[model samples]
Target: MSANRYPLEVDVAIVGSGPTSAAYARILSELAPEARIAMFEVGPSISNPPGAHVKNIGDPAARAAAQRASEGPGAGAATVNSPGEVKAGTRQARPGTFLLTEGYAADGEDGLPVAAMSSNVGGMGAHWTGACPRPGGAERIGFLDDLDALLAEAERLLGVTTQAFEQAPLPQKVRELLAAQVDQDRVAEYRVQPMPLAVHRRPEGQLVWSGADVVMGEATRNNENFTLFDNSLVRRVLTDGAAASGVELSDQLTGQQYQVAARCVVVGADALRTPQLLWASGIRPEALGRYLNDQAQVVFASRLRGVEASQGAGAPGAGLSEQSGVSWVPYTDEEPFHGQIMQLDASPVPLADDDPVVPGSIVGLGLFCAKDLSAQDRVEFDDQVPDFYGMPSMRIHYRLSEADHQVIERAKQQIVRLGHAVGDPLDERPFVMPPGSSLHYQGTTRMGTADDGTSVCSPDSEVWQVPGLFVAGNGVIPTATACNPTLTSVALAVRGARRIAEKLNNSLLMSKSDNRMSE
Candidate 1:
């Protein structure tokens, strides 16, 4: 697109093309219909529909190829490593995903050695597992004036549905068994049910996972005011005094730079890069990259007590199609960690090279513990070292507190109980993954009630001192949550985008009044 023409000015300049940015694009374009929106993505479009989830690809080889296209900066190449060789560490080593340390070979170098991210039009939305569970108990954000309304709106945008696995017989049984285990723990208040997913299930049993494309709504096709620029990286957020003026972006394919002026700038470039870009622009807030936190994950597998190991629906190597499992135990104050139980066609845990999971013989359980947020844990940038993209090189500083460890221990105990309720634990039993394994990192550019040193943004996701500058994605979430953060992140971005639209509308009114007075 840049080969033909470039946008010199836009009403809104979105820095990343992901779920959060999609939320911003959706609300801003609809409310501020006259506002021009230009969304810049650093990675090329890997799928046919620019922002479609790669999981929608039917062919295994093609899906793997798509993932190869979006591998993180650290991923050198997708090698055909055996399951034992590509051990699921802090983050699961799926065919398409790789750890942040993959290219560096710097395991144990940081608190979050396995932290990983993909680069593409949909951002993490393209690779996410599509879990869209609602936050409960301590997981909910407190500073918001009204959170329920925002969450509902976000769900609508993502096309969240419980029907993803409604017809699958295995999930109901797994849910009932997990619910029984919860009852035994005397925390039945925390319901156990099929995971709420961002998916559209067709009548013929095809599952369509929602990525940024779903939230973009009509903006992806019909809106003339919206434009998505793939393979473009936002270098800096341009500001005039305290107001955000626009952004300086460069084509990743070509080294050409283009300045797109705008009334507002919203950076939803994931948790890690969002702060890096803000720091590069010298918007160095006291909490620019502080309060970096992620949920501690403990995963285990077990063979079902009653069900026989048969080639089931979507099992790998089975003559059937595939459908990923989505079910969990809702987070509760009593049980600080959330329990995720799923009946994958294959076992999630592989105790050995010939792990029964390969034979589709067992169910998998994952426990995610929300960490204790602290200022000491941070992501520091080095000016001397420019990263692969020429941005300030990033180093994550993270540590699980003693309390966080105890939370993990409690989670292990709960998972054991749940494991026993449905099936016997596999030989590997329960184990804690390395830091950042949860991959749901949050709170770097966190939103607070005030512009205090503790937070980078205000309650509305606007940068504290930078009036027209805003931040979104997992970074802006201030809460320590156990549920997947996508739904919540989108909700907050929607709130912020709405505020942006309101301001744009007000500015237009003021301009109209001035013209009438001159007449």
Candidate 2:
């Protein structure tokens, strides 16, 4: 189908539909009750998670079988996406495994990194482990205290359930093992308990908790002002002169081009896709696609012999209880959000790909997230590789710094100490890698005041180059804090949506006043 000839108008246009899109849409609806919004997603609705991302169809019925057997709702959502029968080169290739784009070959000498984006109603949130953490300390520079109010609003709109965690049906041993990480000195060192998440926990059950699926459906979907368009991939911004006026999109399912004009545009494509969208639209700034950050991850695996197989929603092992200048969860400081400590409740066998080895035994994964490397790396559009839609695909060029390595090394030592605290038998060795070797990549279109020339958005997350355009998600984050970026992304979206509504409301009131004066 051809492009919509007349301007398809709305009060706001949200580019992506992850947690950011849903949360912001709620805020906009409340603040501007009469305002119309256009929410576009390049994937299917929540009803069919598999159809949303083609990769979820791996082995055809494999995912469905797994989901039926597993406690997690959508555990079996991926379908292997490789050509033919899963050959050596195609084993890991699955439809929702990573974001896919059809566009130009990247500009880098080595070419762009594999760029994967979630194509679902909830976008990446659908595949997420439901980790929700707010940025603290240095990471709070770009965002103001007004963010707290926004966060509260997000919690309500997103239906975040705190009581959910208390109810997870976890195994007894799993609970003890995770809680043990916070004994005495360990608590003193970290100064916090396990990080609170957005997942719904079944407090009285066997310790099992579903992720964020509880509040996302039906309830929030009831808003009449909130409209969602699935299977619609955004192509580029429709601009007037240099300012963004709206967006041009292609309905992936039907091969149709459409446009949604808004007085304001909000880009919430997360860290990976947000930068490329800005660049594709000619929104330039020193930091548009620079300072690419990711957490460096290392894992230590072993098995607890006496522990029975995991049956319930396992408590996230001390899950997110520790933080330092270089590390947050199982990742380190060198790569910013790179290091993450994953305490997976599972058995261990020798396997490869990404993940560190403990050298012996089976149990759980003690992931080490390293520090953030404040290096200048980035994502941009490759002029050569074009997708079926003919838009430029993203090209990413990134690496870690020496500071990142030291953080990982220190993390290994801490992992050993943590093992001791939990009284678990563990191998004292750790696997290693180059900084940024593990992807949790973020921070391309950072937000800051005008004084910080590297930033593309203001403190309020408004794009400097395009006044009406705002950015939410990891792309606009000034720093990659030790926590997962989703909660903060939602918070920022709420904040930005309020700003958009206020501006539009003021504009309408002024226009009406002028009309009356003219009469």
Candidate 3:
């Protein structure tokens, strides 16, 4: 857990230090107090003295991930130059596919693969809108009872906060909009709770922020057991056949590599990278890189007349006032991905795709996320598209099915209805409309009854083929729920940690009893 020293051995080795990994580490510490656990992160650890990316808003890690995406199949292609040269950025524009690092996604008519989003450190959680919603009955009917318990466990580990937002003022436009909807019974059954956030909330003046640095950050520096390795990129999982024994990693800064062992291994490296790591390690199942799904997101921007100025897009210090809920109801559809609608309060700052006409304004962003029903969407590893470190990048294959289109239409109609209730005319067109805009990647490695079909892990998240290997995060979701996968992933990781602890305890007891009998 020290910056200067690398841990030689650990009871558990967690590949990612994101929300899921964080939850697993915390649970392991509580359940097995004396068990030595080491959490490895490819990025620089979050310190009291924050990096330039977190402090100055430069976000180097994000830049690297973006670069990796850009160099892949569709988004990054070579173009013929005037002076008899081939260029990297001069080809036909393609919407990057969002998928995993190990599987081959089917190409379009032109035979080019799609690109998916990837990140280091807190991963996607760093750029998330922070809206947490649980899956409905329609989404969970197929799984076992342990899923219900795991979902409950997830809520507890996330410090699910519903009453915390009462102290802050509700945005005037949001309040008016919700009031009108309630009066019309359009949202009669649903209740908006405080958005569940992983970070701790601090009182005003209690913590001082000088630019991007939060001096008294307890989440990162205060925990003695919490060890974070920043700027370290994981290359592959080290294993023998299906059994995972250790992890092979490379330092993003120095390009140094090492192999670290663990009693149990948990992978939380997002939907894309998790599979890639598994594949590189030669741990393959028919389901390893298949069934990749992401929440279809459509972004809408509107200028409000009376709302106060927003700090920026995904502003770290900006206060979230009166968090709202994602209202969803189950409607049985032939589609594989569930349909749900979520309302998010986004800052007016320029995002990745901002309209030229209204680049800067009081923008209220609305994102409608749905699931992908088709199995055609997938991921593949390309040796051609390489990063600075020469590690292969994932070629993501993603496209919206008819189900996604219908769900988007429904969400648009709902938005219009809400506008009419508030005595405001709805805008006819959105700023950027896409099939799978919301980046909630999930369901690549699903949990199932056995190893032959429909699963990479069992009901308890144990790798079906390997005893010590475990899968976590959105990558292992059995079904793509309509809600954000972060909460669900964290919950699954916690449940997995508990199961590991139980197995370990039983094994130790049996060994001790055998020794006593022999004596």
lDDT of each: 0.78, 0.53, 0.53
lDDT by residue for model 3 (479-509), tens: 7566667767776787788987776677778
Models 1 onward score TM values of 0.91, 0.74, 0.73
Candidates by TM-score, descending order: 1, 2, 3
**Candidate 1 Cα misplacement greater than 4 A, ranges:** 1-4, 75-110, 184-189, 202-205, 308-311, 314-324, 346-361, 516-519
Better of 1 and 3 by lDDT: 1
TM-score of 1: 0.91
Highest-TM-score candidate: 1
Of 2 and 3, the candidate ahead on TM-score is: 2
lDDT of 3: 0.53
Per-residue lDDT of model 2, residues 1-519, tens digit only: 244532478878888877776666766766676777778776566434221221122354643332222212223445443222222323221334343432212344222233345456666555454555455545554337587776666666555543433333232333355445633343332333334445432343322222223323443355565677766778787778767799988877668777778778888776767776776777767777777776554555334344333332322232111110011232222323322333342211122232332211223333434344454466666656764346566655655456656666766665555455444545556554333323345677777768466777887788886788888777666775655666666777777877888998898899999999999
Which stretches of candidate 3 lie above 4 Å from their native place? 1-5, 46-119, 167-176, 179-199, 203-226, 301-317, 321-367, 383-385, 423-426, 510-519
Ranking by lDDT: 1, 2, 3
Q: List all candidate RMSDs to the true structure.
A: 3.3, 7.4, 7.4
